[model samples]
Target chain A: MVFTTIVNCVRARGPDEFWRKRRIFKLAAHYIGRRRNCYTVAIKIVHRALVYATKGRQLRKQDITELRNARIIAGCEQHGLNFNDLREGLLRCNIMLNRKTLADLAAWEPYSFKALTDIAKQKTKEDGFGSVKDLQAPVGVITRGMSK
Target chain B: MSVLKRVQQWATFARIWHVYDATWQNPFQSAELLKKYLMGIHKPIYHPMNDCGDHVIVINSLDIALPGNEWAKRVYFHHTGYPGGATWTLAWELHRKDPTMILKKAVYNSMDGNLQRRYTMERLHIFPDGNVPPELMGNVSNQIRQIRPMPKRLDHYTKEEVEKFPKIIDYPKDYILR
Candidate 1:
């Protein structure tokens, strides 16, 4: 009951209250405002703090995947394959890939990803899926620490 | 092995193996061991004020084993509180997407970051794949030791503690597990 009341009170606060950079800016404020002696309040408050500290942990992979997508999108564009054509054509084509694995190989071994892309391009042309792009990537196109 | 000798062995092993095979994935599963291993508590070097500890590196993080239905019911949540204050994800989803991470996270969290925290951290090695840290493996030269099984552990709370989960309750019956 106190938690709900506290939450309600915090929610009642006007727009100006700087909610602690989170959605329920009020929950913390209400409990904090009153030096609640209740042991339950103290425990609940600490639990929420732990959740905040560890929150960044879960997002690490999503960020890495986003980086991979950027690299592939750039690679596709350079080869004259638009993102739309690449996305659609790659789907129907027999390419079995995921952004992470593809990006890893593309980064560590561009030639390999290029070779795969070349086959993909050929399939696209054969099936009349999209424009044929050059697979003759520049030599030494690889980057440091990219050898997957 | 004598309890004293066994304690010393565990400390050395904890420092050497960052990702222990038996209970590394869910550090919480063997939290008592991890804590003892990292704290140098098992050894006579046990000084509450002093920080004597070892580092560990874990390999085969993705292949880590789990023992119960916890992966389904457990939910990890975080919130930035801009518009949608809370974001929630399931433990199984987390494991399938990146199995190694959750264990790494769980181990790190259960660990106490005291004065010796960094030193203890130095011993921990967590790999997403089963790749061992070659440099650290060199330190584990003594094959005389076997891979010690982590003793099973679980968190126990007095029924009195569970009562306080809710901030306020008028009736004692409210806490009874429904």
Candidate 2:
């Protein structure tokens, strides 16, 4: 049947507002899930909602990576290279450390980042890339990287 | 003319498959405990019929720890019963060939013998690489924050990996001949 029909049939007199709504939708999905024509739609809706809820759980992590990256970028700027240049330094040198660990070092110790920058600059010069910044500008913007 | 514009979503990371990095130190001790965490075993919402395990992607499988001399002294036994058909091998030999197998076998033993276990095991992946392709898609990005308390893991070492480990083993400078 239609949503209105399921809603009317499944309505409850429960005191809890959230529980009442959950019961209504669940009953509706249950009804639809049993019907050949509507079962796919109902399951899709449920899975969609579950994934949406799960997605919310990942927000905290994204925020933190941004914060850490910001700190590292700032550290790089103080060394006369913007975040862009420093990343070029890494790419030019083919450094393998992940963003999290690299950022942590930048935030925790200044000299270490300087050391990495110095090493990267030397490597870039040896590679004939002229200033690691010219090389790194593109790498930092790579939006889709594989292997987390 | 009607046209359908396709939308492409680019993901930045991969799903958090339960990837475990095993050291030669502790590879297989509390494998049962890890199974519970990997499978989401302690949930009221856990449907025994459903594949409810979270994705885990592990690295450093070769670094897991094990107790005693199981790698050397303890022999894995098998037999076909022809003339001298019995066979046995030490864990040390297996270490060089397949380090991940030590822990994989432990996990297999801990999992229930059922269809659900099969699917859950599929989600539990292990790799030796330092980085993997991101499993997250679109503007969605997930960061890994592994401050969670680890459940006990199974022993990973042969007695040699354990006894030789610096964390457990110690010697004075004079003890070294060099």
DockQ of each: 0.01, 0.01
User: How high is the TM-score of chain B in model 2?
Assistant: 0.57
RMSD of 2: 18.4
lDDT of 1: 0.56
- TM-score for all models, in order of appearance: 0.35, 0.35
Model 2 misplaced stretches (Cα beyond 4 Å): A1-148, B1-16, B78-86, B129-178
Model 2 lDDT tens row, B1-178: 2232222111111233344445443555546645755675432122344344556555566666567767677565668879899987677766677766766777777887876777777765565444555651221232222323346453854777766666744567679665
Residue A12 lDDT (model 1): 39
| Cα lDDT of model 1 by residue, A1-148, tens digit | 4555655676535565343234343334556633233445644775687587677566766666656665676566546565555665556564667777766765556567666565556555545655554343334433222334
Interface RMSD to the true structure, each candidate: 22.5, 18.0
Give the range of the ten consecutive residues with the poorest summed lDDT in model 2 chain A. Answer: A138-147
